[model samples]
Target: MDCILHTERLTKEFKGFVAVDKVDLRVRRGDIHALIGPNGAGKTTCFNLLTKFLTPTSGRIVFNGHEITHDTPARIAERGVIRSFQISAVFPHMTVLENVRVALQKKLATSFHFWKPERSLDGLNARAIELLREVDLAPYAHLTTVELSYGRKRALEIATTLAMEPELMLLDEPTQGMGSEDVDRIRQLIKRVSAGRTILMVEHNMSVVSSIADTITVLARGATLAEGPYAEVSKNPSVIEAYMGSASVELVGAH
Candidate 1:
């Protein structure tokens, strides 16, 4: 299988507590892979380790066949592994278009040239608008980000992430606090954006995961409990027990 990202026994510990146990995760290229588990299952910790926010206790992370376990977060991003929401990329005061324009600045290698005339950035507007359109935010391009609805803000975030030209996008809880309508929208948005890229998201919404994820890896107590398509993983006894029965029902229902 053409894996774009994978880990070999990746582990992390804090003050004698093993947060993320040895995890062997493999994400296929052009697939929407999900990392899911109950609260405190070390999902975020695994993401931190993957993005180099927290150093791993041991094991190696390989992306596109290169070892990135020890690389800095910036270096990982430079390598085209971009994690969204770990660092908020949005500027609330900026217009939606301007926000994406700022993210596009990195590609021009002029991100720090604040003194450049406003017209210097005019060249970025067209591409920025295209990205906004991709996430259905083009209509709000002239609005300040702070004025957008919560779901729209998240959509804007996706646009900014796209501006980075990521090969592998890591999304943390893309639908965490949304109503069902918003959830479905973002779920579809995620599906739409996954066309030519690989997405590895740590998601809690089983419905969203079932609908869009090509493969699911269920984590519990810092270790993988199950890994497969939702149809298969949802039936795993251990995964059901980890959710204490209720979520298993939800998983099956979602499937």
Candidate 2:
């Protein structure tokens, strides 16, 4: 398999307590890989390690054939690994078009001016509009992000992430806090955007994971307990055991 992101013995510790314990994770190019686990599973820590937000205590992270363990967050992003935060990280006061345009502006690396008009940026609006359309937010381009529904705001955030032109998009719960319909829309949007790019997301919505993930990794106690296609991992006794007494046992779409 051609892996765009691979980690070897990735470990993180805080005050002598292991958070991610020697995790070997591989995400193939063009795959919608999912990381799933119950609360306290250190999934967030593992994500931080991969994104270079938190340095690993030990081990290495390779992306697109380059070792990036020592890379800064901006450098990691420059390497085409972009992460969306758990919350919708849109500018509430800015229009949807302006929000996406801001991301494009960042990509151009111009001196960021907080008070500048969107039109003054020159050559950003057209690209931003295209991105908004890509995420189905074009129709709402003029609306301030604060006026958008939660789902629409999430969509806008994705449009902003897309503005970076990432080769690998690391989405932290792309569908979190969404209603059923919104979840379905985001799932379809993810499918659309993932056509030529890779996606590695931490998602708890099993239905979404089952519907979209090519591979799923189940983590417990800071280590991977099961890793495979959803069909195989869902039936693993240890996976079920780890989720025992948890809502995931019912919610997971392994069956």
Candidate 3:
């Protein structure tokens, strides 16, 4: 399979410390690749580098056969790589429909026209509603963003990112801070949304990651501990020691 995103010896350094240390990663076209790690494992740093939020200290980043290591975030985004934050990132003062409309306007490159109402943009309202429905937020389309529950806000974030029409999505802990029911809902939404694109996410929830990840890469102390299917990773001694060892066994069991 062709890799839509590939990094060769990708490294990031902060002063004297190495955050991401010479890692090689490949995300195949249309595959949902999960990056799993403990806190401070440099997963977010990797995403930032890939998105060109931070320039890599060393190594190369290629997207669709183009060397994009030095590209700007907007340039990278223009090439169809978009990231959704771990924190809910929508306009709290805006209505649900308006929030999605903002995303649509940006995607349509109509954000410069301050005088034009969203309805005036070509296909804007219809496209916004379609994205809302895709994320299961159409029912609350007219409600204020602040009125929606935390879980729904996350869903809205996904919908907004989808409105960008990206070919590859980088999701940072998409289900963070949600209850079991909400987690399940977002998990299903992720699977639904990723049908035609590549998805790379940093997730700590084992059951959720195991259930949906087409391929899992385990990170430990800023390096890959294991990379393979969940079943293959589950039995790896290094992965077990990093996450399910005796010290962490109780915590894993509690979940």
Candidate 4:
């Protein structure tokens, strides 16, 4: 398999607590992978370690065959590893189109040049609108971000992430607080936009994971408990006990 990203003995520690312990993750190129576990299972910590948001105590991270364990978050982003936050991260006061344009500005080398005339950014509008259309937010492009529904706001966030043209997009909890309809919408949007890219997501929605993720890694107490497809990992005894503490409840399509 062609792995776009992988880690060897990736570990992180805080004082006496180990947040992430010796995880070996292999994310195949062009695949939608999921990291899942109960709360505090080190899913987010693993993400931080991969993105260089947090330093690893001991490990090596390779992206597209280059070791990036010591790279800064900016450096990682430059290599096309972009991450979205658990919370909605758009400019709430700005128009939806403007929010996406702001992200696109970085590609134009004008992200920090506020003194430039606003029309200097007009060249980015067409691309920004295309990103919005990819996430189904083009119809809401003229509206202020604050006026959007929560799910639409998340969709806009995806648009902004897309503006970065990420090779590996790490989405943290993409459907955390959405209703069923919104969850399905975001799920479909993710599927649609993943056509030519790789996605590694931290998600608790089992149905979403089962339907979309090509691979699933289950963590427990800062360690990998299982790694495989949803059907295989969901039925693993250790993963079942780690999640529900009982064999009766199935993990597949539970949400």
Candidate 5:
């Protein structure tokens, strides 16, 4: 399979501590790759590095055959790599349709033009509504974001991310803080969105990872402890030891 994202010896250091040690990561095109680890295992740090939120202390990050280790976050995003659904990314006061339309504005490079007539930007509404439908948020189009439930809020964010037409999306814990039903909904949403695109997610929920992730990478102590499908990685002694007592509990229902 062709790799959409690749990292070699990716490292991040804070003073004397290495938050993310030399790590090699590869995410295949159109694959849902999950990065899993225990607390303080540097999963998020590695995510930051991949998304260019943090410069690597040492390493190379290549996306779609271009080296982006030193690229700015905006530059990386312009290359079709986008991070989604940040809580702050949505404006609670704006209507759901307005929120998505704002995101479309970013792609149109008209986000800064407040003087433009509303009709001038009407072209974006159709595309924004299309994205809303894609994420199942079309019904809530005219509702204020604050009126939506937390789960729907996340879905709205996904719609916003889609407006960018990303080829690679970095999602950190898409199902975090959700109930079982919400988890399932988001899982299906993620699957729905992964078409023709690659997703790299840092998630802790084993069940979610098992069901949706095409590939899983386990990290321990800021290093890659294991990498493969969930079934293989789950049985690895090193991974079991890292999760210890909770491994079986967490992975019991995982296939």
Candidate 6:
């Protein structure tokens, strides 16, 4: 399979410490690839490098066939690669419709047209409403963002990312802090939204990752320890010894 994103010997050094060791990563077109590791395992650092938020100390990052190791984050986003954070990112004071409208406005490059009547902008309201519906936030469209639950904020975040029409999305713990129902909802939303797009997510919950990930990469101590399909990686002795679960809990339930 052709990789939508590929990293070769990617490494990041902060002063004398290496946060991301020489790690190679591949996310194939239209695949949901999960990156899992303990805290300080370099998952976020890897994300930073991929998104060009941080320049790598060494190695190449290829996206859609071009070397993007030196590209700016905005330039990468223009190439249809986007990432959402573990923390909620939304204008809590804005109404749900207004929040999504802002995101759509950014993608449409209409931020400078503030004087224009928002309703008159072709497809603005329609598109925002569509995205809101896509993430199951339609009913809350007119509600203030602060009125929505934490999980709804996450859904809104995903909707905002979708407005960019990304080819690949890097999600950092998309379901963090969600209740079981909310987790399941977001999992379903991810599946629904990622139909034709590739997703690389850093997830610690075995059950969540197992349910959604097409492939899994395990990192420990800032290096890739193992990688494969969920079943294979779970059974790998190295993974079992290091990342089987919190305290080697039976992974069977995860699947």
Scored by lDDT, the top model is: 4
lDDT score, candidate 5: 0.87
Q: How well is each residue in 1-255 modelled by candidate 1, as lDDT tens digits?
A: 999999999999999999999999999999999999989999999999999999999999999999999899999999999877734458999899999998899866898887879898999999999999999999999999999888888888999899999999999998878898888889999999999999999998888888889999999989988999988988887787788655535455432
Candidate 5 local lDDT, 2-104, one digit each (tens):
9999999999999989998889999999899999988889988888888888889999999999999989999999999998633436899999999998889
Which stretches in model 5 have alpha-carbon errors above 4 Å? 85-88, 245-250, 253-255
Off by more than 4 A, model 6: 117-122, 244-255
lDDT of 1 at 127: 98
**What overall lDDT goes with each candidate model?**
0.90, 0.89, 0.87, 0.93, 0.87, 0.88
Report, for all candidates in order, the number of backbone clashes.
Answer: 0, 0, 0, 0, 0, 0
Q: Which ten residues in a row have the lowest lDDT in candidate 1?
A: 246-255
Among residues 3 or more apart in sequence or in different chains, the pairs in candidate 6 whose N, CA or C atoms overlap within 3 Å are none
Which of candidates 2 and 4 reaches a greater lDDT?
A: 4
Q: Quick one: how many clashes does candidate 1 have?
A: 0
Native-to-model Cα distance after best TM-score fit, residue 15 in candidate 2, in Å: 0.7
Overall local distance difference test of candidate 1: 0.90
TM-score for all models, in order of appearance: 0.96, 0.94, 0.94, 0.98, 0.95, 0.94
Candidate 2 lDDT over residue span 208-231, tens digit each? 998899999988889989899988
lDDT of 4 by residue, 12-97 (tens): 99998999999999999999999999999999999999998899999999999999999999999999999999988889999999
Flag regions of model 1 displaced more than 4 Å.
86-89, 245-250, 253-255
What is candidate 3's lDDT per residue for 62-88, written digit by digit as tens? 999999999999999999999998778
